[model samples]
Target chain A: MEIKTRQFKAVARQELNNPNSRIFLDLLPVVLSSLRQLAMASFPDPEAAQRLGGIIRAEALSRLPELLEQFEKNALKAGAKVFWAGDAHAANAYILELARNNQVDFVTKGKSMVTEEMGINEVLEKNGIEVYETDLGEFIAQLLKRPPFHIVGPAANVPPPEIRDIFIEKGIMENPTVDPRELGYAARLYLRDRFSRMKMGITGINFAVAETGTIINVENEGNIRFNKSSPKIQVSVMTLEKVIPNLKDAMHMLRLVSRNCTGQHIGAYASMDTGPRKKDEMDGPDELHIIILDNGRTRLYQNVKTRQALQCIRCGGCLNICPVFGIIGGFPYGWVYSGPMGQLLTPLLLGLSGCHDHIWACTGCGACKANCPAGIDHPRVLHYLREMEVQGEKSLDAVPPPFTEDMAYKAFSVIASNPTLWKLTSKIIRTVLNRNAQDGKLSKGPGPLETWLAGRDFPQMGDKTFHERWKEIENNPPKAVLEN
Target chain B: MKTVSLFVPCIVDLFLPDIGEAMARLLKRLGLSLVYHDAQTCCGQPAFHGGRNPEAVKLAKRFIEIFENDETIVCPSGSCVVMVKKHYPELLADDPAWLKRAQAVAERIFELSEFIVDIMGIADVGASFSGKVAYHESCQLSRELGVVEQPKTLIRAVNGTELVPLNGAAVCCGFGGHFSVTYADISEALVKEKAVHYIASKADLLVISEPGCFLNINGYLSRNHPEHKAMHIAEFLAGKQN
Candidate 1:
């Protein structure tokens, strides 16, 4: 939640050195990709599913204002209150006010990135209200006091030994146990009391149906279901783009969301909430509130190139497949979102200048684009962000050019246009680099080449240019080479 | 009777001329006459990826003017061919006249393996190599260009050559031009992971089509694991030393 994205280099270095994270990152993608491929095979046409997902999100975004109003009216009619927050500050203040007004001491929270984006836990704690993360991963992350490593499995990368120690320190376990089942039991025992005593609960809405004021939360664990149904006061928070036109569209999108998010045909729980308890109902929340937070999304929506980022279902598929995240994990992203989606959204939300560090980390491999169920072209969006940084757009003046990359590119273009000039430049660079070469390759380089030479060798340029060889080949062509 | 003009990438021109020479030899052996346009140098990918649109535009236009007339244009590098086929239209999108030329010239460009297998209809190339060879799928050729099968088919045709499968073959080797140098740690980390899988395959040679992957993988192999080797597909099929 805190903006430490500018420290990507340092964070990446730390992550790369941590062998624990590397082992987890390396194994997870292989397992997840296979699971996803298998789950996706069940669809008659996977591309069609992705296209439908993209189309539904695009339609929602095209008429966002109307859909939000429709959702508000329908929700109000269903006896649930709807509140609008323009940004993170307003979102945080409203939640804190709700807590204070009700004299609530402790609240249970389902996994919600929007809440993290608003820094609600810190705000609520500052106002003397305690918040408990009900999601298993989030609970572990809370115990460890670190940001979630992955979107779905936030503490999945964190080793069980470390978790055992955390549980022991937190007084939830009598002894350290490496077995994850024991840890789960420990967590369940600890959170069960909190669930029974908690007067208020909070959650994130995966999809909001506009036809009826219904919100859907899909999860493997049943924490969110309890967080919503067991508590008297319940609030579901979502960003503006989470709303869909109707239940049919919501169901259509859910098929891809579950499959893409964690490679599941269906999550164990799909808790759908319409409103509070009625006289006929046995048990439900007494109060239902939905907070739609903008927080820079409206600005992002105005830009055509960037609105594609909103289509993300937070599947974390891109993160699992991303080689960058495969090495560094999510901390370097410095926010709730990570991987391809984070690289695009972080800069848009945190301003390009400050968050431009991770934006440039993308290798333009297009793996994220290929894996995305939403059809978000992350490389294109990332390149657009880089271009914004290079051109020093009005919004990005605060982001100084990290290096003279533009100047080098300009020089490259000039040399590339004229073959004679290019020939001369290549010879000069090769000659200079050869002085440091050993065995036709420079094992250790000087100046800027040090980065490349840090681990791998730079192959020395050939003694003669291809042009020189081509001239000789032309003068004396190979005689009857092979069949010809 | 196909007349193929060779689009030698800037890196091939300077760093690895053997690849270009091998390509020329192989294409000639397949009975395709080759034309080398000396005016050609770079494909503007470095500038294009670096976000210098205006400068990349200049180089891209130069490429169009030089190669627009050639009916069949082939290059040893997948990255270069991708630049011409994919990004050129994007670069010159604002200029209709240039955009048309770029789009036209784009259809004419092909990577070496794809051209050999698809256009020339020659997968074997009447070549033989006796060893276990793992074909590293350069990102541009396999994922970006969708030429995944062409290279594999060619490799399988080589007599006595066992084509071993590579894990994460479609993943990047992290030789993203300036990316290797700018983000050296991440780049090195990636290439190291690549090397680990490559070694695990127990293949004597690692073959690739793109100049960048060739340079990066060979660079790592030559330094860390000197016994291992990586070669461009052109050089490997030509029975030439990589």
Candidate 2:
């Protein structure tokens, strides 16, 4: 997928006007968030439950290298082949080689953001191995070649009419229909054929338990279950941070993930794979390959602060609660991740140069922080990213802000530090801004105010600022008698 | 008499000074002595939000120097208070003396409603309003400072004022300091949705605890639905009988 993080404003404006997306943007977030609130109420102490999730993730990330090694050792002991890939190319190469060695004509896949991040499907297709995304949303998104609109639902924002067109074009349905269930049924039939005949299946791990070397996946759809069971060969990939210390931590994370993602008490299926099928097993993969991909994550982990980006559980909780994401949908994020998750991670993974706009788009609202089960302080992270961008960091490829912006803040600091200067500057600004006033408001102004004035009338600067009016207010006697 | 020093935010100091005056009146009416520091400038929120940490640190030091001596410091803006209470310590972490001052000053500072209900233990300030009103929970005030019920407690105590529920009341109004200007399109969409929810609520007025939110929401309201109005919580609770 193309990186459009730089085109945030353009895509956001386009999405704001697109009625098809507007409908979903308005409904999905509100519904999901409210449902999330209700589901979280089931916890004896919701806040404590959320805090525990954060503690678990933080502890996991803190001991990430050791946990990964332990997980690899235990998985290897369980007869699973554990391959450590330092980057995306290595991971993709190994998977491709495995496919070629097995002489697999086609492969089925479960919904996996890591696979998408690696552009694994494109690589496999380019190498003449067909890849089928069996998750319904992923299937539609793959067919349309669009990034996931929402993390949980890849093509969720795509209107039914558009889906009907895509389904018809792809021969997923015999007749045209706009009903979602009917479309889903059509997709189910279409993908079921691939699931049965596919020799290999690929999936992303939600949690790789270090204690038991078991990989767990929580999903509403059963495609992942099929991805593990029906194929002769199963390849599950995870980033270095996915390994938790034990299954208990995984269970706690599972509760938070399900409740936060779709407001369910739990997902429809929780599948765990310790290794490939035993000789006595009736239905399971004969060969299980577990690939742990780093792909710059270790570089991120080297910095104590940036390591928080890996704490994200891919639950889409932050996306649901984010007000900015609530308005523009996910296209403007211009990456595999969107909302606060994308805003923070994209800058780290893609570098600050290309993802500058994503860092500054937040309202500094702590909604994402308050909602996150992983305990990531998104607003603080964004602030840190912004600081890095303005100051420039060689390691992150963060270039210092433009001369004009740098100078503007410098001037601001000077004026703000001195009260006399602030008071004087306020007077001059008041005089200049009031010139554009009509009916006590400025409908138009210069520079930064121009964008604001386009949609809302700015209040004319007060003639006598509070600083100028303080004496009179102080001298006046109290107006109301205390009613105690 | 307990003296409460005022830390008027730059926004209230410039475009919405009436909020500052209203805060003074309400505090004075509650029998507290108010002191306005002539040398107090800003909490350095814009600089901080702009990612200019050095600039923010300079202003944070200046803010600390001005207000650190006061026993109780109060502000009408939640974001400014958040800058002082939350970010200041972090910004000044490298400097031990300033970090200590920031932490000390942070404990004494409070948002208006927070000071009133939590500190002063006053819910009713002999104020009255006649019509239905809904509170727009400013993100900084409600989430950051955990000042959710303080403002509402004061509003609910207003004689004849019926506090109504607002949809997504705690969501951001999109005036993220520089965010409103840089990402104007997304900001407009969010503020528009906020206005839409306010109008749908059928309340006569919307009350906000932060001046930044007041500017953004009231700006949108004034332009599109000029008939409706949004007031700072200080102004609303300062005995403006509507």
Best by DockQ: 2
Chain B in candidate 2 has what TM-score? 0.98
The TM-scores of all predictions, comma-separated, are: 0.97, 0.98
* Model 2, span A360-439: residue lDDT tens: 88898899999999999998888888889988887888988889988888898888877788888998998888889899
lDDT at A46 for candidate 2?
99
DockQ for candidate 1, C-alpha atoms: 0.60
Candidate 1 residue B215 C-alpha distance from true site, Å: 0.8
Please state the error at residue A421 of candidate 1 in Å: 1.4
> What are the runs in model 2 whose C-alpha is more than 4 Å off?
A481-484
lDDT of 1 by residue, A324-389 (tens): 788789888888888999998888888887786667887778888888877788988887787777
- Against the true structure, candidate 1 reaches a TM-score of 0.97
lDDT of 2 by residue, B1-242 (tens): 99999999988988898889889999998889989999987888888888889999999988898888999999998889999999999999988988999999999999999999999999998888889999999998888899999999999999889999998898888999889998888898899989989999999999999999999999999889999889999988886545
Where's the lowest-lDDT run of ten residues in candidate 2 chain A?
A475-484
lDDT of 1 by residue, B1-242 (tens): 67889998988888898888888888887877889999998888887777777888899899999999999999998888889999999878888988999999999899999998898788887777789999888877777899999999999998789999998888888888878888889888899989999999999899998899888888888889999989899888876642
